[model samples]
Structure formats: structure tokens, C-alpha cells
Target: MLQAREGTCNWKANAASGMAVHDDCKLRFLELKAKRTHRFIVFKIEEKQKQVVVEKVGEPTQNYDDFTASLPVDECRYAVYDFDFVTAENCQKSRIFFIAWSPDTSRVRSKMIYASSKDRFKRELDGIQVELQATDPTEMGLDVIKSRAN
Candidate 1:
């Protein structure tokens, strides 16, 4: 049987979930942040590897629809989106949103794992302004995001 090594820095595993956040996840996030190289990123837990991995990165030109379309209909995922909007004062602003998507149709086990690992994962990304959890598409619709941005 495989046993977890305590205090090992190589895998950044969370004690409660035994899930590690892959290094590339943070690296890609940095690119999106410092360079404006990406519009969004999608993350998923690889059950077999017990690690959270970067599954997709949306191009800078991609829209909200592209981000929404990236999420699986029957799975749980973690994502970060750079949302741009015009405020009431006509100021153009952008906010980095961290979204936890656990669709109702996903397996309970998957939902629980993602929930347990979310805090640890998000803590590593640094600079996320808004956090949203959704169990359905409507819960994360553009209108909802716009409201949250304000």
C-alpha cells in the first residue's frame, strides 16, 4: 500500500483531500496575470494522480461564452476568469474571478473532493478578487457575473 509522506514539499498535497495542486497551474495563472496572455483557465482533479491539473487555457480573445463552454456538463471543475466590465461611472475595470463549478449531475464523490481541495488550491493562486460556486450554468451566467463585478 502507498502511504503519504508528511511534510514533503515536492507534491503540495492537502492533508484533508490528499490532492496536490500541480505546479503548472500556478505558472499558467501567472502568465494570465502578468502578461494578459490568457482570458481564463480551467482546472480538474485527476483522480488517479490525486492532483489538480490545468486542463485548458482560454486565449486572450475568448469571450465569456468560451469560458462557460469549457466547463463539462456533468463534472466538477475549478476556473479563473479575467472579467472586464464598465462600471456605473464609465470606468473600465477588470477582476479575476475564481469559480468553482460543481454541476448537479456530477458524482457526489467528485463534488466532495473538489470542495475539499478548493481552498488549498485557490490559496496558491494569489490575486483572485471574486469567488463563485455554481451547481448549474445559470448560477454562473454573465448577468450574475456582471452583478458580482459591481
Candidate 2:
């Protein structure tokens, strides 16, 4: 298992719930947010490693549906999406959202881990405009996202 080290402090010791956010997770998010190289990114905690990792990356051309579909039906995940929409004024706008996907059917332990580590992981990815926690698909639907974006 890989351990993240910063100065003399082990990430596991300083991080919330002893879970560390992997460096690649932040790097990938920067690519998506700053460079617009990706539409979204799915992240999962490796139980054995006790670290958050990038599980998948949606291509720039992928739609919101694709981002939603990437999440497992019975698993907990962390994701970031670049949401684009037109405001009531007909002006185009974009928002970067940090989504916490914890479905009802997922294991309780998984949910606990994700819930505990979310803040630590989120802090690594700079410039997230909104945060959404969804227990079902409907909670993160396009309409809901658009409302949040506006």
C-alpha cells in the first residue's frame, strides 16, 4: 500500500478518518478543472490502501449522463463534474461540482469511510464551486444540478 507523506506528517495521521487522498486524484482534478481536459472524474477509496484514488475519467465530449452512469449502483464514490448550462438571461455558465455518491444499497462501512474522508479529499481539489451529496440518482439529476448552478 502506498502512503502519502508531507514533511514529517504522514497523511494518514493528519487526514480525517485516517484516509489519505492520493496525489493523482488532485492532479487529475486539476486537469479537468483548470485545463478542461476531462469532463468528470470518478474516485474510490481503496480499502486496503486507505487512500482515495482516481477510478475513471470522463472525456471532454462526454455528457452529464455519462458522468452519472460511471457511478456504481451499489457503491460509494466521489466525483467532480464540470457542469455547463445557460442561465435565464441566455448567458452560458459553468460550475464545477464535487459530488458524493452514496447509494442506499451500498455497504454501511463504505458509506462511513467516504463520509469521513470527503472533507480531506475535497480540500485537495481547488476551485470546486458546489458540493452535492446524493443518495439516489434523482438527487443529482440535471434539473437539480441546474438549480444548484444557478
The numbered model that scores best in TM-score is: 1
How accurate locally is residue 41 in candidate 2, as Cα lDDT from 0 to 100? 96
TM-score of 1: 0.89
Clash list (residue pairs), candidate 2: none
Note each model's CA RMSD in angstroms.
5.2, 6.3
Cα lDDT tens digits for candidate 1, 26-81: 99999988898999999999999999999999999999999999999999999999
What tens-digit string does per-residue lDDT give for candidate 2 at 1-150? 234345336655554558878899989998988899999999999999999999999999999999998999999999999998988899998899999999999999999889888987888899999999999999999999989998
Error of 2 at 38 (Å): 0.4
Q: TM per model?
A: 0.89, 0.88
Cα deviation of 67, candidate 1, in Å: 0.6
Off by over 4 Å in 2: 1-17
lDDT (Cα, 0-100) at 56 in candidate 2 = 98
